[model samples]
Target: MQAPMTAYKRAWGEASAKLIRKELEKVRQEGDFSEERIAAALRRLGCGRDHGVHLGHGFYSVHTGVACVSGRVAKDEVTSKVHGAYAEPQPGTGPCVENRGGH
Candidate 1:
């Protein structure tokens, strides 16, 4: 059985998706749905930032065609590669940094 919060989140996610689709349709019919315009509409619909809709990290809007992390396939090769490097520390491959002076 799913927790109440999980169920609620799923429901909300679905509703938000529907809303986005509707807005996109409106934009298409109006022939004014540029990428920026779509992004603005999404923001107005509360689909960006700290909103519940997690459209992938670094993904600000849907006009880019980048779906949310949850919307991607768990076993997708591209997703696997991206997720693999998400948290691991990156070793310095450039010139060493030395502290010169402290403010």
Candidate 2:
């Protein structure tokens, strides 16, 4: 049997914030929404203007207890305030990615 992919999945299918940062660099978009256009979006998300890390096509920031990336996959996609945009992530919902601070 196979597990279904959930929205909780990272944009590039990786869990490490470091790895996702690498993949984010390859994304590119048209004018206006260019790689440099993430600042405003970050501010709009209340993540602050300084937290923005323009990664070609999205904005990313990792703080003490929060991480976020904003985007528009396509014009046809519904644009909305997507806090916790994926879903409520619960422990035991899937396999562990990294055992952080575990004894």
Candidate 3:
């Protein structure tokens, strides 16, 4: 049997999809837009604002759906972080990686 989907997850997925579609449309509409400008536009589309979507410890996602963007962080911030508004991680120690049973 398949597992049921949670309301939060469903909503998040929908919103994320919408954001992506909107971004694509924007690109098609305006060819010269930069990544930062596109991200800022997404944030304005009910996604929230920049600086609120931190991925934790200064890491952030430049898009949506990849990370949870609720509570202190706004939806737009989450989107911006995913879109490359933040600095890249240092070489050695990367973000915490989850270990599965494999390998």
Candidate 4:
């Protein structure tokens, strides 16, 4: 069994995911899939600094205060999800697993 989720964790997890989705939408609209541009869009979530935000191989993983938000970004489409304490390992060379503290 797993420990109960803290209120803080639950709140931040949702908030971070929501922000990630919005930023990814901007990414789709902007047509700039560079790491710098994506990171800039997610700046409001306090990514790209202490909390790591890794972007590569068409995938991105951001370690927020309470959860890891991972996503795929394309020139015309973007998708995201908030990782739980132990999400399944992501394929390829993406940082989702590590960023989520899974490995």
Q: What lDDT does each candidate get?
A: 0.36, 0.32, 0.38, 0.67
- lDDT of candidate 3 over 22-102, digit per residue (tens): 554554456534445545554666453333332333232332433332211233332321121113333232221222224
TM-score of each: 0.40, 0.27, 0.35, 0.68
lDDT of 2: 0.32
Q: What is the lDDT of residue 103 in candidate 3?
A: 27
Give model 3's TM-score versus the native structure: 0.35
Error of 3 at 16 (Å): 3.6
Choose the strongest candidate by TM-score.
Answer: 4
By TM-score, the candidates rank as 4, 1, 3, 2
- lDDT string, candidate 4, 58-102, tens digits: 677776656667778997678876654434444432334542324
- Which stretches of candidate 4 lie above 4 Å from their native place? 1-8, 85-103
Candidate number with the higher TM-score (2 or 4): 4
RMSD to truth, every model: 13.2, 12.2, 10.9, 4.8
Whichever of 1 and 4 has more TM-score, that candidate is: 4
Per-residue CA lDDT of model 1 for 1-103, tens digit only, reads 1112355445554554566666555555566534465556667776554432333232222211222222221112111111111111212211111123343
Which of 1 and 2 is ahead in lDDT?
Answer: 1
Ranking by lDDT: 4, 3, 1, 2
